[model samples]
Target: MKKTAQPGIEARKNLDFGLDANTPKYWHSNDPFKTRLHDALQSTFPEGERYFIACVRVFNDRIEDPKLQHEVKEFIHQEAQHGMAHTKYNQLLAQQGMPMKRLLAFHKDKTQKDQKRFSPEFNLALTAAFEHFTALLADAYFSNKETTAGMDPKMKALFAWHAIEEMEHRSVAFNVMKSIAKVGYFKRSCAMVYATWMVMYFMFSFADNMLEADGFSKWQRRKMFFKNLNWMYGYKGILSSFTPSLLRYFKPSFHPEEIPVIHNYPDWVKAYDESGNPHKACEALIAAAH
Candidate 1:
């Protein structure tokens, strides 16, 4: 394969860059509570990366929309970076004393072994639905800072930039699915329901796995899990707004942009050049993590 870097924001049309890798992130790697969270998340980064990998292949095998392909390429570049950064984060966790072997066995390999649980068509549909959900999650992340006061700034910035990009290209996977899978309303609706469950299931599983690693009591882990979720979500306002959109799932006119855009991005994104150039530094996270 002829590999190349993603063009920077000014160089690439339909794309924006939000990475400042030099940003120092604080982690109390020694805290047993924190390390467990790190381990669960370590698996999350790779699993999500694999989803994007599968997506790129979907474009090659299935997508016929040229415009969307360009967007997919942009999405792939950022996602590859997200994976790499997480891989590095995970390695650091392992270095702090959590083995990725068990981590993978639980989260990494489990998400990979998603064969009998769902069909490819269903999976693809769910991927599309979840893409929208992810954008929402990102939007939620950046919309409020009080909930994020003590967060590692590096992770915060990563999620912020990702939220912006997700808002920027939220429709890629859904567009690809309509062009590729040619799925129906019933399948799409079912996929959304399944997508909700799978996301929740995996997220909780990650927390559970982290709890198991801790030498702390079940009650302590339970308290920490809920505390972290609350701290992360802040009155969990994101959920209240996120679910109402599902009613529009099969409504045809419903779209991602109709949901939210982190109070909307700066108007400057509207006037950017669209040359389709790629950027290297951001994409470097992929191989660097490996």
Candidate 2:
């Protein structure tokens, strides 16, 4: 077998995206299925949080790619906020006594291992793939009248906000790869194919792991798992949602705007922020649940 050549990688400046812990969206438990998937997706969160931090760490280590650099900074901004947003929701969920520490630690180790052992191109390639997955989930939440209707408006708003942002920041990682990645076309192609498979596989492993510990009976949990599976499989019909986005990478003329935007949020999410917070009526429901 031929030795695979390592890909070129570069760094970009970190942006100072600050955190505000009291966002309106955090005021209550999101749907249990949605929340479970939240943990599953969030299990991978720190790696992404660190990817940008890593980029910022390495910024001075290599030549800059200007547009890619800005994208990195902005992506980091959104991710940093995402970490905060999810942390709040996850914490409230943790108070349900399903403590996420084990899941968090396990993934943290996996993230570190991947970072040290893999080529930077591989990591960025993986990041791009995961972002595509998130973009779909986010779109589903943002645009689905079914999910959005007749719910706690705050929670509905949370999903919508995340969806728009996912679309907004969709290309950050791959653009960075384009800026500095040096793997040949074959390796790059393999990265996408490999990444797509890896994401589905990871989702399976994550769902299985969470089911074991979420306090559900074997039968009920199995039903929930299938419910999740059905939603995932047809969320936007087949793998077409993912494949279309993935193929764009191969096109020389492909650009971010060419990707479809999923939703126009109701005017309230941005406007809801006097302090970017929800009405205090949420506290009673949350307290009652616990």
Candidate 3:
């Protein structure tokens, strides 16, 4: 397979997402299902991103390519900022009564154990798989209008910035696994399987917790989960557009750069470059969608 360097990973250091009490309870168009789902995922970002950075850092010194080495450092910087940004947002969720401490502590413990039990190469492979998942999510965010149609401006800006950066550095982990760790096709495929199951488990689990906390009984939560299924898997749903890309990960020759970046990528980047604000970048994206 022909390989290439990822586009530059720019660190937009110390970005403040401006989340607070004024942020609505159901921030995603006042839809409980959508808001809870998004909040659950955002809740995991702090710990999950730290785990991602740790996995990549394990192999940093072993990387021989100058370009990959530099990108790895920038990747760490970006991931750190992502963790910090999400930490602030999660605090807001806690203030709104989301049991942030217990849930995140649970996830933190799980990740720490994972580091001890798994080999560094496997953890890095898993990190690559999770990156692929997030890249798919970034595509979903920008490529599907319904996903962001009525999202809160501050929330939209936060996710848009993260998505653009996800696209920017999507290839870093996979390249490190393939080029630096020399992991084989079987292990790489296996890692995706493990990642898919883990993501589905925790994301839904957290979403379920949110719904339960909102006073839903088990039956109501089950009903809501099924109802929201269409939003995720419907013909034009967020996950619907990217099945092919998800499957492409299992191919022996798969590389993240092969998938087309969102069409609005350049416009968003230009907006941020010109204004030095992610909210402006998000506004540019919304304008382009019209």
Instruction: TM-score for candidate 3, please give it.
Output: 0.96
Report residue 28 deviation for candidate 3 (angstroms): 0.7
Best by TM-score: 3
Which of candidates 1 and 3 reaches a greater lDDT? 3
TM-score for each of the candidates:
0.71, 0.69, 0.96
Spell out the clash pairs found in candidate 1.
6-278, 6-279, 7-277, 7-278, 7-279, 13-274
lDDT of 3 at 115: 83
lDDT of 1 by residue, 1-290 (tens): 12123223211223323323432323322344443554464457667667755844654656666766677777677667667656666666555445466756666566666633766766678777777777776545455543344445455444544555666666666766676777677887887887778666765666566556545578887787676554344455445545555555657655555564544344223322222222332222211221
Model 1 gets an lDDT of 0.55
Q: Quantify how close model 1 is to the true structure by its C-alpha RMSD in Å.
A: 8.4
Candidate 1 residue 89 Cα shift, in angstroms, is 0.8
lDDT of 2 by residue, 93-197 (tens): 456454467766766776678778877767666666567667666544444345434345555444445555666676666556555664455655666677667
| Candidate 1's TM-score | 0.71
Q: Which 10 consecutive positions of candidate 1 have the poorest summed lDDT?
A: 281-290
For each candidate, the alpha-carbon lDDT, in order, equals 0.55, 0.53, 0.85
